[model samples]
Target: MGLLFILLLGVAIHWASAAKLGVVQTEGGQVKGKNVKVSLLFRSVDVFKGVPFADVPGMWEKPKPHPGWDGVMRADTYRDRCLQVTLLQKKTRGSEDCLYLNIFVPQGRKLSTNLPVMVYLYGGAFLLGASNDMSFLGVSLYDGKEMADRGGVIVVTVNYRVGPLGFLSSGDARLPGNYALWDQHAAISWVRRNIAGFGGNPDNITLFGQSAGAASVSFQMLSPHSKGLFRRAISQGGVALSPWALQKNPMALTKKIAMKVGCWRMNEDVMIKCLKMSDPVKLTMAGKIDVLLILGKGTVMDLIEFSPVIDGDFIPDEPSKLFHNAAEFDFMAGVNSMDGHIFAGVDVPSINSKTANTTVKSVRGLLAGLTKEKGGAAVESAFSVYSSNWGSHPDPAVIKKTVADIETDFLFLVPTQIALQLHANNASGARTFSYLFSMKTRIPGFPSWVQAEHAEELQYLFGKPFSMPLIYFPRHRDLSKYMIAYWTNFARTGDPSIGESSVPAVWPAFTENRRVYLDINHKISKTSVSSDLRSYYVSYWTETYSLLPSTRQTGVLRAGDLSPPRGRPESSARET
Candidate 1:
């Protein structure tokens, strides 16, 4: 009996030794990860969850490298997510000890292996999001394992601070904001130093994200702080050029929170100290943040409150001006068909119930005020360009649809186009590609016209339909495969079509003269290769609005003054 037990213990020790890593260990210690078999690909991948990549700094301070520790930290489970408010701010979950990141490496790799690495950042309007096993209908929305297996690369999903804890700034030396940006920067630095331990090629890293995460990828590309951390970038449905990407008044939320917590003092430094000592849960729900764009007549636009601001150190200047180094990056960006449903549905609520043209009346008044500022011709030209031409007594549903289209054009479509053009021009043939995801995948219960809403393409890219086959249609599986291939290919090589995997259609590069983009819609088909989508409207925004007294340096163009207004979305962007 003793001999049999000794033999079993020796075999267990042998298997453990085989899995042990070399000199590339986390700051805390060595991590013990599990080998998860990806059923769809019939392959297994090594996953290390809750790895402490950095030790986040205090209340409003920047993050630093994690101090080394004594022994193995056991990274098999997800650590606490950064403290955040959820369930309508009625309750809160997560903790300040939440600077952990999850790493996924493809199986059959060794110390000598040199695979490409992709770091993912989640988007919650910079208010709320997590990198820990996000799922709906049994689909892991942001699983890095699926990408690792499909792309044959190493994948990293990082957790950065959000909301007041992450972005509160006084626009001064006392309380500089952008702690979240520092968190992301530190994570990338950690990858550059430590990813080689897992057989990852640190020199060939790709940064990709959706919405605010996509905006962060843009920041990472443009900011001098992230100069040599990454070489490639992809932004989907969002970019730093979007009006909501930068904060107008970084100090407003700080004041509100200080008042609620009874920490309101004359000095900013004193306020920071009080905030650090308060209960984190109370801190989460304390402040009532009134977001951006108060137009003429005190009309507030729909925009997120907690986003990065110009601390003059991290951001340095306006987003548009920072693209001078664009030639160094291989860039890809695009938008969804109805990305603005999140804004319009709230701005024009329950079309049938609010049938008295209540929403329309408010919008018209808002337009009149805006035209008053710019000119009467502004409203005239806007209506001329976007005239639905619906006869009297038009369906309220149609009115809501029009609002959605208007929002989509201003917020998602045009901003993405301007950004694509900027990168393509500056890249000087370094391979920039753009695409529009128009897959007829509308949110359930939303109006039929609201097709391909924002963040819908993410699931397909993350391989949700493949994992939950019974819940989706066959077309979904096909699209998911194509997206995974294209994305991983971009991460591996500078070009999307030059890799081991095969994609359905060859994705073309975007250039100034070509003005090309790939339209990815499997259900309702369009020409695979297209050019300058909606040129007339694009011209309307780029030409007419460029004349307005807007500052790209500040990134503060109100949707109403620049175009048309339909801005509220905190109650709406989350439903879908």
Candidate 2:
């Protein structure tokens, strides 16, 4: 009995020693994480959740780096998300002090591994999102554990301010918005400074995102302030050139939202001070005006009202004009098969409720607003083009598809094409690669006719959340595997297919004449589609308007630039 007791005590001591091995020493303090089994046969991966990279003091202020802590901080669970409105106009669980980031590292790996890092920024139309496990609409998204485990690379998902709290602008430094973008910059800076402690190569960080997050990535690539923070970037389904990506006459919108909150319009400074003292919830809810304009009836023009703006310091010029500077970094941009389906889905209400003339007029108003009167003739020309293609259909269903197709080309495909052309023509280093995800998503609740709606590619790259169905398993698992390989390979080396793995196809660089893109379905195929329709639209819009200049540097153009009361001669050029 005495011998057996001694043996049991020895085993207990050994087990306790093994448990302490998961502790990682960060600059802030020592944090202990747990090993999570992400795959059946593979070993567990270590995840440290809710690690504070910045200290956010309430709303409307910039984030500060977290001061070092005194002792061990147990990073075992997620912290509250940053304050933002949720789906269905409900306020979700989050706080102003929510500037945390989650990190996933390979378990039992030595410090010498020095894995490449991929940091993700979630997309929510610049409104709703968090760093923890949550699905946007039906697309289950935002987990780095699977990426870290499967790809053998470190993954970090960050949280920043969203909604009006992140992007409200007084058009000056006094109450300059884009605090959300600064929060992301702070995260990147923190990673650059401290990522080496977690077995990640700080020099090789890659920034990638979808939707508004993708737009943010584009801004980062263009901003001189964000230079050297990331080595490469991947922007999916969004670009800075999209009219919806930038707000016009932002101060007017700011004053309007302030009025809704009972703060009478005064000078910009006084109004900003009044807003700082108002109820934070009321301030956040007041932003629903931008929402109504964006997602309500009429055109899909306002669907992205609260997005990133040119704040002089961060974004100097329109991204299209700034491509010469952006050509320095390696870039990859892509789109889905049915990128227009989202706009089409939104158009159902407008078509059902409004008359055809009203719909056409609403679209024309959107075109004039988006193109600043220069594209008026082009808009008239486009209506004819669509009518001829769609058989001049007066039917609402035909009209809806036509409108969706036009918007798809206008909002996503054409802008991407222009960006790729600029980058390919001017980039100093790596050649740009583009892709088209054409696979029909098996995720439940997605319409069968919808081929890869906006962000379905997220599931293929990062495994779906457990709450969602296992739609991509067994059959499409290889696609996910190759995608992980492709992404991580790009992070390690500038080229995706240059690594040791046997990638199925050789992805060619995009060029003006070729316009080649990889079509990812059951099998990956390299092909180029006829671009006659797209080329015509692109030529008209580019010829009509110059790239929009920064509002801070140029002041609000809409307030002064609109056709002057029908009496004065119009300026030769207008800012759009």
Candidate 3:
């Protein structure tokens, strides 16, 4: 009788263990996950589902009363991506309730081990992206079992509101603008609260993003609300302090959007009610009507109008001003070699009298607003230098390219360099490392002329070149290993160059004097490709401008306006 009782008890225990470690069904499908054998916590594979982060009471304005998940969500499949205004026909289905996140971990892992956590923010010009995109699927990025065997880490990808819904600012108290930024905060909070259930260490989170996502990471660093949420950050292309990036001025832009959507005439309460009653698809379409107008306008515009707000609650001040004052955290920021060339078009000659005058006035206004103190002479000197440098170029195309390059550097690279310099100078013990991705890939339809274009490093970092049409070379795996190791190592320790595990080259530290950059090419070396250009930009920016509040200044002459003079500038047009 005693022997029989012992056998029965052992069998019951084994069955209970197996049942505890069974699979959990999610909205998309079933994923095998585990439940703690000793502890009562359930480490399920799919824990989060499509959860709304904010409530858009009205269609034309910012969100209100952020929303939270009501129950344990089954996050087996990716939620539908946000609604996009597609020029090309593509399947699209998602709700405004699409602020969602996904967590991936080893099939069966214990929570006792505090694994490093990587929270990914996707990139689509802060307008389009989702956690469910195949490109963002992290299982292949970090092989769970392999990582666990070596050293465990958790990967979390989150989706935030985008486009008009997230960025359109009303600059009104009724509309707390930058709802998308709010969504990101909510997602981070969720990770802090629930990532532990998946064997992730919330305390050691590494925030990383590419392109617009990278810019978002920089924004988080500046945000007081995001303090302590992440220990480390990596920005691929987008840096927060760029002159051309978005600034938060919600009221004006939100009012414009409201007017465009036919709700501007109504009171706030009435507008909100009308927007809520309208069809979501109609609102989405109406929102996209201003894409062309807002194309060149980036986060820098937000500095004056609407992007990420400087609300006392979320963001306190401009990231540039903030970083310049003091460094609160560590960062890894960089830009691609040919970032400007990818988006470049055929160049044009000097602007005509009308265009030139408009351009001058616009430039003057921007400089005046940025530099609240009188610095007109300095601004003119800077412009004269730019004009002379541009004029010296023999080829009109080359001159245009240089202008575009300046714009790109001003809006992206310079800000990144500033942030790195600030962090290196101010941070207590934390270090700042910088790199320039110059490795050009040989992919079909990759415009052989444009080498190492914008967002090119994404393939190498992700260890998969899906966007690349074809892989002609065999060194892809080598590059992938090198990049992944460097990135993962950074995530492990705040330093990216802690050790040379599997990477081929030795990445050096970025110092004020040395100014070393990891030149990623066939033979990755530390060198400066455009020292002259870099020097010119640094000098011009430093010598010019005053820091002041940004304001609305329109009628700026853009490159797009300079189409070849109609009918050779002398022919009369036919009446319609």
Top candidate on TM-score is 1
Per-candidate local distance difference test:
0.73, 0.67, 0.53
Instruction: For each of the candidates, give the backbone clash count.
Output: 1, 2, 16
Instruction: Say which prediction, candidate 1 or candidate 3, comes out ahead on lDDT.
Output: 1
**Superposing all C-alpha atoms, what RMSD in Å does each candidate have to the true structure?**
6.6, 8.1, 11.6
Stretches > 4 Å off in candidate 2: 1-21, 40-42, 108-112, 133-140, 289-297, 350-376, 391-400, 443-449, 465-470, 511-514, 526-537, 543-576
Residue 290 in candidate 3, Cα distance off native in Å: 3.2
Candidate 3 wrong stretches, greater than 4 Å = 1-74, 87-93, 106-112, 134-152, 266-278, 289-306, 324-328, 346-397, 400-404, 441-448, 465-472, 511-515, 526-533, 545-576
TM-score, cand. 3 vs. native: 0.70
What lDDT does candidate 3 reach at residue 248?
A: 39
Report clash pairs, candidate 2. Answer: 294-302, 294-303
Higher-ranked by TM-score: 1 or 3: 1
Candidate 1: what lDDT?
0.73
TM-score, model 1 to reference: 0.85
Off by over 4 Å in 1: 1-24, 40-42, 109-112, 137-139, 266-279, 288-303, 351-381, 388-398, 523-526, 549-576
lDDT tens per residue, model 2, 1-576:
999998788655444332223677877778877666544333456778889998765567788768868778888788888777767766544688888888888653233257788888888788878876464564326767667766777899999888778898877787678888899898988888888888889988888888788878877777888767878888888777665677656787688778989875667778888988887777777775344554443455555668777778777766666767677678888777667667655644453333443266655544444444343554565566555544444655555545555666667766666677677777887567777667775655543344667787887788553223354455476677667777777777877777544566776666545555666655653432222224444453343233333223321112211111121111110000
